[model samples]
Target: MRALIIIDVQKDFLANGFLVVPEGEKVIPVINNINHHFDVVVATKDWHPASHKSFACNHHEREVGEIVEVNDLPQILWPAHCVSNSDGAKFPEDLNTKVIEKVFEKGTKEDVDDYSGFFDNGKLNDTGLHDYLQSKGVKEVYVAGIALDFCVKYTALDAKALGYKTFMIEDASKGINFRPNDVQNAIIDMKVSGIRVIHSRELEKVFSGDY
Candidate 1:
């Protein structure tokens, strides 16, 4: 079966948000338009605690964009975003969430950061996404969402690692280019790992079973 795994489309990643990705809002319509074409659809959320170690606010005079170590893991300190039960953590009203079957919450552990929808940064914890997809008989997964360089990229990589035939929808995702060429490098990494990068338009006929 085919699945569309959407990553971190929460309010905090939108325009004027704490960790906005460039053109993140643009993916909402694209995702909405194609979600029905899939056999199943699931979403992921950041769902961080207020004091998550990845947030700069919890550190002593530390600012966003700073890198720190927690539990021997390197972490990029971002502005506190997607705090659990907060407005920032909620999906925007305009996003078509009715199509989402389940929402896997990540980064809930205050001491760890989870960039992938499937696993934490340490790869020590699983978010149950893989098993859930397995239960749904998903063999091919189409990944799209905000921040292509981070959450979206990691999710796609993990999906591939878990033996799913993975594809990344470039037109249905946006990147957080915090540094030069971060997006380009991420795409290359996925390609090296055998993940196909395609545009949403390319899937129309395939999804409709008319190809």
Candidate 2:
């Protein structure tokens, strides 16, 4: 069975939100439409604490997008976003959440940042997403969501490494960094790890037989 893994499609990633991804809002319709064709739909949300170490607000010298070494891991300091119980953490109002079978809350710990839905940065713990999908007998996963160079890329890499046939729908993802060739770099990385990259409109052709 195949599943659609929607990562961090939250209000905070929208145009008006704290840490908006460029053109992030454009992916919603594509995600909503493809969700109907999948056997299972799972979503991930960034549920962080206000004082989470990943936030630039918590680090005096760092600014948003500044990279720092934390616990020997390269961490990007972001503006405080997706705080649990806050409006920014909520799913985008237009996202079709009713069809999502499982909603995974990640990055809640004050010390660790979980960019991938599969595991935390240090691989300290599982998000339980992989096991959950396996338990449901899911063999293939198609990933879509905000921040293509971060969450979306890491999730796809982890999924592909775990032996799932993973595909990343590029049109359904946006980059927060807006770095030169970041999207292209992510595509190259995904391909190197054996993950297929495609546009949302090509899903029908890529995953045939009713998806």
Candidate 3:
């Protein structure tokens, strides 16, 4: 069976929000259109605490975009977005949440940051996503959402490592691109790790039994 994973399509990552991903809003329509094609659709959210260590504001000396070590994992200091129960943490109003079968919340721990839907950055704790997918008999996963270079990339890589056939819906995702070529490098890394990167249109053919 195939599953569709929507990674962090929250308000904080969209335009007019903190830590905005360039053209992030553009992926929503594509995601909505492709969601129904998969057998199961799951969504992941970065439900962090206000004092989460990943937030740059929590560290006095560090600034947003700065890197620091938290719980032995290299963490990027972001602008305190996606606090639990906050508007920023909620999925955008336009996202087709009705099609999502399960919603997995990650990064709830105040001490560690979870960039992957499957596990925390340290790999010490899982968000229960892998087990859930396995229980559902999901053999292939198609991922799409905001910030392709970060959460989406990590999730796809973890899925591949966990023995699932992973494919990244390139056009259905966007990235922050903090550094030059960050998005491109992420795509290369994912491909190198055996994740198939394809556009949403290509996936449409697969869903329609034309591929």
**lDDT of residue 98 for candidate 1:** 86
Tens-place lDDT per residue, model 3, 10-93, is 999988888799999999999989887889899999998899999999998889989998878888889989999999998999
> Could you give the candidate ranking by TM-score, starting with the highest?
3, 1, 2
* Ranking of candidates on lDDT, top first: 3, 1, 2
On lDDT, the stronger of 2 and 3 is 3
Candidate 2 off by > 4 Å: 209-211
Model 3 residue 204 distance off true place after TM-score fit, in angstroms: 3.9
* lDDT by residue (tens digit), candidate 2, 24-75: 9998998988898799999999999999999998988888888887789988
CA lDDT, every prediction? 0.92, 0.91, 0.92
Q: Give TM-scores for every candidate, taking all chains together and pairing residue i with residue i.
A: 0.96, 0.96, 0.96
Rate residue 56 of model 3 by lDDT.
94
lDDT of 1 by residue, 110-193 (tens): 999999999999999999999999999999999999889999899999999989999999999999888899999999999999
Model 2 / residue 74 / CA error / Å: 1.4
Q: After superposing candidate 3, which stretches have Cα over 4 Å from the reference?
A: 207-211
